[model samples]
Target: MRCCLARRRAANSPQKTQVSLPEMKEQLSQLIQQALDALAADGRLPEATQPTIVIERTRDASHGDLASNVALTLAKAAGYKPRDLAGMICDALPASPLVSRTEVAGPGFINFFLSGDSSRAVVQRVLTEGEQFGRSNAGAGRRVQVEFVSANPTGPLHVGHGRGAAVGDSICRLLSATGWSVASEFYYNDAGAQISNLALSVQARCRGLGPDDAQWPEDGYRGDYIADVATAYLAGEKIDATDRHVAGKADPDDLDAIRDFAVAYLRREQDLDLKAFAVHFDRYFLESSLYESGEVEATVARLVANGHTYEQDGALWLRTTAFGDDKDRVMRKREGGYTYFLPDVAYHFNKWQRGFERVINEQGADHHSTVTRVRAGLQALQADIPQGWPDYVLHQMVTVMRDGSEVKLSKRAGSYVTLRDLIDEVGCDATRYFLVARAPSSQLTFDIDLALSQSNDNPVYYIQYAHARACSVRAKLAEQGWDWEQARGIAALPRLEEEQEKALIKRLDQYPEVVAGAALASEPHTVANYLRELAAEFHSYYNAHKLLVDDGELRDARIALSEAVRQVVANGLWLLGVNAPEAM
Candidate 1:
């Protein structure tokens, strides 16, 4: 995680210009478009032909700031050698202040060299924009609903659910930052066979029967938390869930009452866990509501009317195979209950009706099979919903390690490590950071020892420590009777031409691009990785240069750079649902 900013040019190098990165990319694209237009005008290329102007950042700085393969892409179509076409395009390129030079490298790739001032301007931009530096209107105010951690209200949230929550909440934050009117939702499967099993489990515990007791249901949950619920129920406890409140009855034989109380009680527990992790949902959608509102039945009738469904062996079947599923799926069994897939389709249809044209469901990898089935069901409705109507982000399971072994079970959850156990042991900040610092498709190992460590090994501590160090520098400045003058710091930015200073500024400049990329890819781990690198850059800069120098201008400039680093780290951490402790 110790990332050093790219090395700066020698002092005698050519002076750099002051263009923003986004503006520079735009200018480069426009210049290439103009070049292509000139070629077409001269009959060198077809008048009706146009290609996308794609500009990408060079992986190696020696190549240039940005590069394009337009010359190579258009060579065959334009009837010229790639190199010859590149030369023609370069010749027609418009002169602009943003471009210091342009070069054609390897197989006709055009590279643009920007002035030093272009990268240096990011410092001033960061200062001017403050917390709004990396935000953009890319989403165009579109509405997007992100549903995550839709764990059934049967038990406390486990580590897998924690991963989903961290990722889902971060996605909402990322979408909001990029101009999407985002809504976070949690779908609860409150009425189902699992719920029935939960009720039986709690009822068995209420009757003084443990998992080993003969009277316990064969498939009942054996989590110790079940016992706690049973004790509370026997004492007539009132539990307030997200949507309702229910007081448990002491009647062990009343399965209906037990089911209701168990769902409400577990939901309340989940609410507390999410609150502790700083995750908030805008909506709590219930599966039972779909059935109660007649949406499920209506969905079935629509599928039948659309010729996508038929009856087989007294069960209604949807022709999911027509939509690429391996076989037809049962919408409802002969016994009268709808299968899980039907309810999912109803939920998504309801989401579409509610005006969420874009929806993302963040769930565990175990639910991968449901993706095709649900989308196929939606397609059968002929509702004009896109083939891939609702998007999915599936995260692999998380394994918690402790004392040189995997901590497989939580005493309360029985079969898995509960999220509350993690929060209680390693704290919310570390837990969230650990869960979200990797790609969702990759399995994660949540090492408790590493997370709890205060040393550099813990990324959360390392990043937070960098922020604290920056704050300490400001405090030191005041203690020495040298107040930070905003005007002076802004004016002396150009004097911050040292290699370390330029490197830090370059890292700061990358924040906007990082945010936009992460948002577009629906990967918040990109931001997490970026923050870690930014922290490393700050720490390296701090160690190499003294902030409290005798030169007033240099001191103010360094302090300004440190402050920008602090701002970015705080902003990125906020996106991850982690607190940026000022005194970590």
Candidate 2:
């Protein structure tokens, strides 16, 4: 991403600023699109009007920094051959100092070789923008709400939830980094049967039953934290009731005592665990609150009033099938209990009502069925959403491994590993990176051995080490009494011809485009991949180039380049909540 550091403070946070881009690439892409459209009109090609012009780096430096495959992609439909079309498209390209030459490569791929001057200009933008590298307001004024790690307040979050935590959190950061009014929320499931079971299990434990006791439901939560919570609640309750003498009134103190103890205990566990794994939530929305406000009932009533609900078998059923659900889902079950769907709809509706134009929910793939139902409900009650509504992102599961064996995570069985346990074993940075290293849609095996492996095999540590090394270089620069602030600019940089430096700079240049593309596509995992790739480029650059040369201008230029690399690494890690330490 091209570094341009123009940023505005986040609405809710004073510590964080939202980055805005310089809009150079979008301008360039528009220009290229126009060229393609013009070429098609000249009858040199068929339908080049809407081409997927990918401006990417060519493997061969002889080709260029930004390569376009518009000509090659249109080859089949366009009567003209690939090379002929490429030539025509080349002829149609707008004249600009940014683009030095356009060449047709293997299979008629049109590659634009940009000038060093253009690359130099990007660094100047980076220096000028400071910390807003790769920022853009493409989202304009739209509000986007990202609800993630909505882990039911059942037990401590597990290693399996780590990926969703990392992915969802990173996504929110990416959206916020752009110009979206992004709100991060953690959906607390405090009302479901899950919570009821938790309360029941705590009561059972209060009666001094074993964790494996039959009184504990077969499907109840079984993590160590449950026992801890139950023990703490019981101790606090007995201690409180014994000390208080309320004649006839139910002491609100006792109720609060239990709730506060439980919430505080669990909150501490979450903070400690997430800190270990580097995930954070901006807001925690309690499910009970939604019910308390009668929003859930109101939503159901509104749906019924809209003819989007029907009564069947003495139960309220949503006509979700009308809007693409596999079948109508029960809004309220025959037992007179509302299903999770009802409250979920109301919660999201409340989010939209709170002025968020877009609501994004990231759930585990196990919630695939629920996702469908939720989307269906939203579509059935689409009238509720003024414009943009809730979008469900169902990420595949993450399985944990220890010494090459799979660790089962069944929240229902009352036996599983916690996210805290994973961090205690592998550290947070590794945990976060490993989860986000892959596409969220792809199920990943969280291999403990691979993560702990000290070799370059550990990608998270590899990236972190690169950052630490860069910082160490800066320290070295300071120790040498070199003034980093008064460093020479990129133009002062020699015809930077080192294959490694050129490659790193090229990768850096692609950052803005990747960020914009990812934000527009609503695919934040792309940013994660881009980070890993950028870090790798820096590592390669570090290993190959000697930055402390005697040539002052070149040395300063290299230092500036390294600083930019460090800035990006820190920015990426900041999004992930992973530290960019001065030393490993």
Full-model lDDT for every candidate: 0.88, 0.69
Off by over 4 Å in 1: 1-19, 33-51, 70-94, 103-110
| Candidate 2: tens digits of C-alpha lDDT, residues 517-583 | 7666656667667778888888888877788777765777787778777877777776655667778
lDDT of 1: 0.88
Quote the positional error of residue 227 for candidate 1 in Å.
Answer: 0.7
Highest TM-score, which number? 1
Off by over 4 Å in 2: 1-59, 69-80, 88-96, 212-220, 237-264, 275-278, 382-388, 409-414
CA-only RMSD, every prediction = 5.1, 7.2
Q: How far is candidate 1 from the true structure (C-alpha RMSD, Å)?
A: 5.1
Candidate 1 lDDT tens digits, 537-577: 88898888899998987787788788888888888998898
Error of 2 at 135 (Å): 1.3
Predicted structure with the largest lDDT when compared to the true one: 1
| All candidates: TM-score | 0.92, 0.83
